[model samples]
Target: MNIYLVYWNSLNKFCFRGILDESIGEGTHFLIPWVQKPYIFDIKTRPHTFSSISGTKDLQMVNLTLRVLSRPDTAKLPVIVQNLGLEYDEKVLPSIGNEVLKSVVAQFNADQLLTERPQVSALVKETLVRRARDFNILLDDVAITHLSLCWKFVTGGNCQRCLEDAVTRIGSSCRKKEDGRALNSGCYLRHSPHKFYNNSSSNDVAAGNRGHRKMAIILAASSAVLALLLVTATMGFFIRKNVMRKRRERKQFGTLLDTVNKSKLNVPYEILEKATNYFNDDNKLGQGGSGSVYKGVMPDGNTVAVKRLSFNSTQWVDHFFNEVNLISGVHHKNDERRKNTYTSESLRQRFNRDSGMHS
Candidate 1:
């Protein structure tokens, strides 16, 4: 009689008669003796900590750390064991994590990555969870724990020796792309070298394979001048565009203020922020197709709706601007009509009072 005790946190799959094809869960009295093989898996959640070095959109190297809480789905164990063996997470998680890291980090510049860390983490987690699900893995939590610029090494002289050394030292960290190539992907995440050396093409021949003594200085100066020119052009364009946008908004706002003077709803935006607790999640009322609306309590015991539109959404800017125009025009017209009605009522009352006094 062959029998084994199975614990609650563990799952067991057995094979009978040297064949695992659609037959499983052996090592029982019902199975023939010496014909069953057993495999056990622990279904416990575990923390996976990994560090990835990737290049940012601004061409800076970033070292990021991610901690993931994950476990295998017990139902998919058979397929996972067959395809990936027992060490499945080892073969899958790191590769996919590194890939997602590179793809997401490349989209954001270093400053944006730092300023908008939450959004970055959310993006990484959303993509990583989907990838893990494809492998029958369930992720409970994913977060970016630490981040810093990869300042391990600075600028280096352009030479084949430096290139070969970089390839040899941290080469193992590089991952193979989906195309099945073992190229030097690691160098992309590391310090930026003065030159890139590949087998297909050599470094500049006219530069005479020398160190960056003269060539480096001249190149650095030229790059600085070019960067300055580009920055000046970009700043000028943005400043002009911003001025135009503000001018239009102010023009619309002026019309509203002229009609709605001394209106109760004329509260400052800062006051709205205070009333809604700075757009706290708890104050959220409901989300519409266009944006989210929140419940706000004014200092004067007035309840107001605070609408916040998502600027990053694919929605057209014209739609938002048009909505603003409609709101302003409606309020201005209403105020003007009310003022005319009040004037006519006051004149009628004065005419009746004077006639009675004369009598």
Candidate 2:
């Protein structure tokens, strides 16, 4: 029969055939048979107690006494023998314990750890369990055995004094309430009419002040609306004035154009050609009743629309000027009748010219 002592180590797995060496330490090691071999293991759960000082969320120093129970898994013995040689505890346990304690204590304050021991213990246990899981080890329990404040290190005075004062106040109040004379006299239940009336009057005054404030707010809002209306009206008046001024200027320009056209009526054909780009298609803007309107730019950079009338037209130049004057007079009155009449006459003349029907 072949016997073997399989054990775990930090670096490699170890297997000892036959009996194990008794002199070897609490780690996995080899042994031989008959000559001298007895396997001894430090399989017992290791207890580690350490003191750690850390800060809580509120930046207070906390003193913690932590106890950790750490041991390797028996089921993982085969893997441990194959992977890590004997001496896993020395390599793994110390570092794991330190990390677990620090991580657990970081979540709590000194006062909470002292008062709520169960919660702190749960946190420590959870930290150790999670850390050990990665190593294939079992963390039995992590206990917070002791937690206290070092007042001299943290604060100048003793915390016991404050606790004593609170206890004294509670005791006195309880004793006074239990006394028969104090209960019968109703000293604690004394009523004041003046205080009641004053509170009532204050409430009424507050209500009235609220109503006044609401009215003031409403008045202020109305004044703002009125001011806006006045500003809008003033802007509208100025805008209308500007529009009317532009229309008057356009009318005066039209009258001046009519006068210039009249003066050019006696000018020869050659002069008209030089003035209107030889009646070129590029210079033409539109065709109207009297003639074609051409867009022309003078040497002075002024743009003008040149209207060229056809030759041998029966209507004289005076008749066209009279019609233009009549349209301008009605434009200031804002009447649609005169404008419609002018447009109708222009349309009739254009139709006659295009259809080759004279007169």
Candidate 3:
């Protein structure tokens, strides 16, 4: 027989015949020789402190001190041992903590982390807990005990003096307040029940107030200039659009007038009167129900039949329609070489040429 020691405070089991798994308890136990091997695990709560170097959202490098309280998940002891072996803490905790710290730090700026430590620490704890669960580690708590820039920012002599004054003011003004931090461009002073920062005096708080006021003034001026520029641009755009629209309309109208003029014959009233010999009865050709026709000699020494419509007649609209259709289709041809009768198209072409010369 063989004797084995097992503890109930942790998960203890025995492997029998290399194939059978059985859970055991605390105290001394007897087992057949070469029949079983006892496996004991330590599952105790403990704290781990570590420092990590990472960059914040603002690209400022920061040094962070983190303390984590953790333990092994007793229920998952068999799985942890089987999957990651007994040295899982040594292999996993450091890496998990480093990754979680970096991820959390990247979510906030260095200034924000310093001023709002509680908010930042709470977020880090929540994320670390969830991440630890994946590795079968129980997370009790996570605390960001310290946060600072990795590089020492140089401060001006005046700013340093002001920081000292601000720190003294904060100490006296709100003694009951649990936490306070005096911040400046180059450095900060944080105070609590327990000392957390260097024992250096800080800059003046009035400098910070002046800086905020100047920034506000600049922002207001910039907003006014931007608004003026936007309004000017909007006005210019509409003015240009209206001008271009009017130009397009005028151009279209001119084009339409040119086309209609090219398709029509516009004989001047004076020229018609002269061609018909001032409407002498001798030039009258015939009379129609709507109007009268006369034989006329054009300036080019050609004879044409001009039908003058009577606008006062009640049938003037019907007669005008008939005359338009007749002029569009009427054609005259001369069979002999000396004959030179022109078609209505030729008349319109002649009229355009004559009008162009007069204009």
Candidate 4:
């Protein structure tokens, strides 16, 4: 089952009798179980951050964070495994990166380091790229994400650089590994009357901080205003929709009342409820496909026929309103009973014919 394992986007190291042989490309390559073994290497490009503390030429300690985009060089996979094994980048990048950074940074002064950042980055990347070729690791990109002065930096008088150099020399005496490179007094400023650090630099940094704070505040205010506008628009949309729906309902009620006024058939629901005993089945005289007809006693003790429409059909609403409109202008030939059990079919037919509809 392991022999038929599927793999993609990976490099496989094919070995015979547990000996490092050759690297293979992506695909299923079955092994001979005990005789053959394959080591898989994920050849995906990923970023590695390298942190190193190195002094600038002006003797101010600068901390550097190097972001290196790397992947295993496919052609050199066997050599990579033999040399540094699976954790090749971890073994090689930090050593080379620190060496390259310290060597490159020692050539530039602290003032030039801040002012000429692009040239500094290019030089570091070029040096790292050249050094990485021998390690079988391909560098896609190299960048200095952070370049900052140490927080422990202090400034005093005209002899500040010299004092700083002597103090660093004293501090490096306790460390054995970095003892050789620690006292890097590649000092740019010598016995000069100028201060190594000044008040104006602090003011500039404070101004930059203020500008960033203002930008963040403006961004937050803009986001809040935009959110408020969005909520207002949403609320206005729903409110206007509700108002329009209510207006439409009012218009429909007004129109129904105007049409019923023409036929003089504006009987209130309570009066009809009382007259028909709340639509009791006993009061129902006849039933048809459209509705039921009920006999009712009016307020003047006169007999009346009330038709109740069947609301089960979706077309009932349209049919009910249309019938009222038809009856509104209709004139019967008989001119007889005002309240009858049946509608005037002949008059209704004439109204439908005049109105250009059969029923």
lDDT of 1 at 175: 39
Model 1 misplaced regions, further than 4 Å = 8-32, 150-359
Q: Please write out the lDDT profile of model 4 over residues 1-359, one tens digit for every residue.
A: 35545353333443533444557777776666555656677888889998999988878899999999988888788788777877888889999999999999999988788899999999999999989997878899999999887534445553477557765765555444323323333333222234445589889999999999999999999999999999999999999998997677446545644554566544555566678897789999998656677877878797666776554332433676655455445677642245222223332443334432111
What ranges in model 3 sit over 4 Å off? 9-23, 151-184, 187-359
> TM-score of predicted model 2?
0.33
Candidate 2 off by > 4 Å: 1-40, 78-85, 152-359
Best by lDDT: 4
User: What shift in Å separates residue 50 of candidate 3 from its native position after superposition?
Assistant: 1.9
For every model shown, what is its TM-score relative to the native structure? Answer: 0.39, 0.33, 0.41, 0.41
Q: Write the per-residue lDDT of candidate 2 for residues 1-359, one digit (tens) a residue.
A: 23444452222223434322223334444433444434334556887777777666556666767777777775564454445546665666567766766777677765666677787788778877887777767777778776755442333244445445555654555555532111221112222333433577888999999999999999999999999999999999999998997676446545644555554333333434555677688988888665566765545455555565443332333445554464447544334331111132343444345532111
lDDT of the structure predicted as candidate 1: 0.66
The per-model lDDT (C-alpha) reads: 0.66, 0.56, 0.69, 0.70
Clashing pairs in 3: 162-203, 162-204, 163-202, 163-203, 163-204, 164-202, 164-203
lDDT of 4 at 141: 98
Instruction: Using lDDT as the measure, name the better of candidate 2 and candidate 3.
Output: 3
Q: Candidate 3, after superposition: displacement of residue 203 in Å? A: 31
lDDT leaderboard ranking: 4, 3, 1, 2
